[model samples]
Target: MVTVPELEGTFIEVETLVEEADLSEGPAAVRGVLAELNISEDAFTTEQYTDAVIAHRSA
Candidate 1:
């Protein structure tokens, strides 16, 4: 995982595929992993991230 200070978050890489079944745990599941990494749940801004990705793609 790499800490992206600009994004105030880490870019984590998972070797295996995360299938639809994996989402069964919902948001808590994601929060759990982030907690294990010592990442705060508040660091994620969904709409902001979506816009950033779109802007990057358009660029």
Candidate 2:
């Protein structure tokens, strides 16, 4: 879990492996599951997290 102090917000990222062709259905599936559990996205991001992981591995 990570926190954004200024926004007083917190979030946990859930990841799944999906084929490139299934990219569209992937998000739909995730959103459907989230909706079933009453969860929502306030600020969804992939670029930042991907960059962070790459930088950390290089470091």
Q: CA lDDT of each candidate?
A: 0.60, 0.65
Residue 2, model 2: Cα distance from true site in angstroms: 2.8
Candidate 2, after superposition: displacement of residue 12 in Å? 2.2
Tens digits of per-residue lDDT for model 1, 1-59: 66544454556632333568886556666777777878776665455555666676687
The alpha-carbon lDDT assigned to residue 15 of candidate 2 equals: 64
Q: Give candidate 2 regions above 4 Å deviation.
A: 4-7, 41-59
Candidates in order, TM-scores: namely: 0.42, 0.47
Clashing pairs in 1: none
Work out candidate 1's RMSD over C-alphas. Answer: 5.4
Q: Give the C-alpha lDDT of model 2.
A: 0.65
Residues 1-59, candidate 2: write the lDDT tens digits. Answer: 78644333556666667899888888887777666767766455564655655666687
Candidate 2 versus the native: TM-score? 0.47
